[model samples]
Target chain A: MNARAIDVRGLNKSFGDRHVVRDVSIAVDTGRITGFLGPNGSGKTTTLRLLCGLLTPDSGEGTVLGMDFRARGDAIKRQTGYMTQKFSLYEDMTLEENLAFVARVHGLDNRRERVEDTLHRLGLFDRRQQLAGALSGGWKQRLALAAATLHQPRLLLLDEPTAGVDPKARREFWDEIHTLAAEGLTVLVSTHYMDEAERCHDIGYILYGRLIARGTADAIIRDSGLVTFLGEGPGIDRAAHLLARADGVLSASAFGAAVHVSGLKREALEAALVPWRKEPFRWSEVPPSLEDVFIQLMGRERDERYTS
Target chain B: MTGSLPRILAVLLKEFTQLRRDRITYAMILVMPVMQLLIFGYAINMDPRHLPAAVLSHDTSTVADSVVAALERTGYVDVRYLPRSDEELDQLIRRGQVMLGITIPPDFTRRLLKGERPQILAEADASDPQAAAGALAAVSVLPTEALRHERLGLGAPRSTAPAFEVVVHRRYNPESRSPFHIVPGLLGIILSMTLVMMTAMAVTRERERGTMETLLSTPATPAEIMVGKLTPYVVVGLVQTVVVLGMARVLFSVPMARTPAGWLALACGIVLFIVGNLSLGYLISTLARSQLQAMQMSMFYMLPSIFLSGFAFPFLGLPPWARVLGEIIPVTHFLRIVRGALLKDQVLADMGNDLLALGLFVLAVAGAALGRSRTTLD
Candidate 1:
């Protein structure tokens, strides 16, 4: 083993009576991109915070970069760069000034040279003197990233870093992340976009404070045991509604012009679609996508927790 | 702690840079006290001058002229108008045109000639009680001095009877220069209000913006960050104290009873107290959610300090309950210490209780602030 960059296990965090993160365990290999995906209140941000020592877990034991997560949090924090969900930089300060402040805060030597290089590398050298508040969302994201990585931290924890960014800027940002990963920096990124998760080396899916699955995207899709059938023609939304309540149908969601119906039982899914065949609809069986598998997984987990 | 020194220096440099960018805050921090010193030095006067008086002279003769001369010579009263009737005098008093009304009896000169003790009826407008008392004192002295001359025959007036005596004593501030009293108290008020408010807002703004957590996650500990943030404000506060004291001396002629070194020592103690209070404000800011809430909390604490701290009013004049409330304010004790040392020339031994009170206040507030900062989650 090449020494995991982040090795946290059995992490538990609770905000009063509600458990935010429950007995979560995960590890990221050195220089690998790990995707954290979950619903809105699924503890992804909390887990990311715990991994970077920004928050102290209520209970559990772990190590980040060979430092004890509980005992040597300061050391872990010093070696990690965290980009918050919001655009958090001094709005009154110019782009160059904000970067310089971060550099000075970390006590980086040769501050002027380092700030100059970081600005040039991020393609923000031309807009260096513009105030941070005036920058577009894409430019602000670049500035935040530059500030975060200025200290050359060993790990990067990005919490929904591309929430408001455009597609082109997001693609460029991912390219930058991959470039940094190539230089031996581990990245733990939480994202809602499925394409972004597919780009990661491995994925962890969390639901309601619990880690439901962890594997490659293809592996998770296959392991879900979801069999999906596409029904395309008129009245797909109405058909999707009928299919959602049908026996043995786990979930039915509209994917573009077609309704994708998925279930864990292959024979039962086909039997349920027999009534739909009476209408003028083109039915075709297809390999279940990552989205279909996750929908079916969410359906099964929701029933398991709620019914019990 | 090998790299701690450099880190501290780095933090200090960063703070100064930020402060430089906040130009409005910097101007308020540096210029307000000096401007206040100039305004209050000239505006506040305890020994009021140019008070208007109405004379109802039934005996409109040379004796009345002589009485007006004596009143003018005292330099406390300005005889504005001579009313013909007592009704007119009453109208003048009611209209606030005159602060005092003097009625010279028709037999005023004849009474002195007959060797009878004549009393001039002097009615004063007591609406503004302090000015009223001063005006009455000025008018009464005029006849008694004239009577003494009449009995002794010093300047050609001869009399058979002696005159009643009048004595006056100015208390608290004998010279009655506003700066002498106000400047010393201002030292306490300015230091406490500005230092506590500024530092509290700065800390709370960072926390609201989520920058405190980012700053804390660095190698800096809570103590290191606090000390770094506090160092510049202490310097700034001391500079302001010196500026205010220097302006008081130049503009108001407020005497500096102690030596420069003594003033410097007092300034250091006051700066320490201010920093401690500011730390307490920081703790309050941490508990508050936003800057507006932090400001409201600061004002809530500040109102009692201003009213009960004996800066604007005399502490001894307050009731017993108010006195107890005054004792609870650190600024109240600090004002006494600074004023006693600078104005009254009292030594440290004479101000032992005040010094102890200030020390206890600083220690208690600082201990609570640091404890809260460590325990609270940002």
Candidate 2:
């Protein structure tokens, strides 16, 4: 049986008069890699921060790692590791020194061995003496991850962990994350990339400080009630702009030679594309992708935010 | 040809918007100069008056009373204490309670009547030579003024020489070297400037550079972080103190504490003072959002510390309100402790009040810093 690592409810956070996280309730199972997906300023980072004791909820009660997150923040912080979106290590210190500082902060025994093991595990041992600030973006992110997990935390919170990394580095970073999760270390990561989201065991979609969707990637897309039609033909991609304004067509965008048009009603979406159903244009019904569902959710919630 | 004018306007407009948003820098720019002008103009009295004095009179005669009255009438010396003995008078001077001490010898009246040119001794605390210079010069005209006093007309014919000579002794800096007074006090000012600014930028630097978020996420408490950051700077402050003290001794020939216990007291005072400033800097770091803001805040603090701490002027020369402000400043107490130990050879027991003040400052500022330090980003 998979134990619950994070079971939090009614999490609310506000900055000044702006409510950044509103009534966010989430639960993550142990050893699961849960991805938080949202647009900019949609409280994914804030919710992750609230769970890992980096920020206190305006009003929330939860148990993280089987302890009260609010009352046992110090204990939670010790057992939990947090990697911020920005590289937050000491730039002036060497990579080894950065990892060693983290090891010492958590008061780990045999600190030298831990630092050396983490450096080698991250493949940074060769460049251990390089200043963190002097390293490139990929190396810096790798060092930050090594430092975050140096204390062997059971729970990891990564905020946009692979934001600006190259594709190869991002793949390696994900592989390392999976290796850690296989060790029964629960991970909570926030990312904007749909490919990264698909790699997670489950996903949480946040919009306007509210968790509007939560489930596995397949389940979320299945429950979105969105219909999509992919069109293929000469100049059929140009029809996306016109179909996007048609009745009941929520989002329409071209993907190279093909165009994916999504909406709630299949008949209305098909009617919106009726103008391009000529010899040069051929359409087929397709399962709405995760990106299609998210675009629909973002549009629906943003409209609600303004109208309400 | 003038296309760049709008771009210049855009940059100027953006600059003003940012400046308006930074309330601390805005207030510093607007409020600092006015406050400094008012303080420097009204509180800094170079030729000060009503200096506290002590009179130890062995002569129980009308002439001694008239002589004390004459000195008081000069509007420079205020004879506030009548100590019973010379040792008590000397203690008052060393304690910094009195700026001047007068001694009326025995048979002062008889010596004046017999044309013996009796000597009335006047001793001034010359640590602040500026404060003592005017008051000491006032003693020179006392003999002529005493004879002119209608109440005690000594009915002596005017002669080439005055009847009695008022012998003046400038204690501590006998040569009235300004460097002796300035250098030791410079130690306090320099430590206040550097230690406070250095540690003041400590937490803010981390915050500005985005490292504070990771640091706070660890199991380290605010107290641990504060101590870990400031303890190193304490060593730095001590090394700075040794360098400045060595320079003061070797270069300026400034007298240091004679006894080893006195040196120990000075060292203790220095440590307490350094810790107090570092704690104050930590408190500023917790309050400031940016390193620039932290620097501005430290500069704001250092102005009052340098001006009102009696490093730039005599402590007694300031008005009562300014002295009250000076008393609250840690530098003021440290300056007194330093000047007293180095100049008067005072030991630990003699500097109890100032040391206690520094201890209280350290406690209060460190406590405030810990209180202000945020464990969470909120």
Question: Per model, how much of the real contact set is kept?
Answer: 0.24, 0.96
Model 1: per-residue Cα lDDT over A1-308, one tens digit each = 34888788899999889899998998888999999998899999888877776677888887888778889887777788988887778888999999998888788999999999999999999999999989999998899899889999999999898998999999999999999999999999999898899889989998888889999999998898888898998877677888999898988988777999998888898999988886678899888887887777777789899999
lDDT tens readout by residue for model 2, B1-378: 599999999999999999999998999998899989989898888887888888888987766577778888998888889998988998899889899998999898777777788899999999989888977877877877775553236665556567788888999989999988999999999999999999999999999999999999999998999999999999999999999999999999999999999999999999999999999999999999898999999999988888888899888878889999999999999999999999988889788999999999999999999999978888
- Each candidate: chain B TM-score: 0.55, 0.95
Model 1 chain B TM at 0.55
DockQ of 1: 0.18
Give the poorly placed runs of model 1, Cα more than 4 Å off. Answer: A278-280, B1-172, B347-349, B374-378
Off by over 4 Å in 2: A306-308, B1-3, B62-64, B113-115, B150-161
RMSD of 1: 15.2
In model 1 chain A, where is the ten-residue run with the lowest total lDDT? A1-10
Worst 10 residues of 2 chain B by lDDT: B149-158
Residue-wise lDDT of candidate 2 within A59-178, one digit each (tens)?
989888989888998898998999999999999999988888898888899999989998889999999999999999899999989988998999999999999999999999999999
| C-alpha RMSD values across all candidates | 15.2, 1.9
Model 1 lDDT on a 0 to 1 scale: 0.76
lDDT for model 2 comes to 0.90
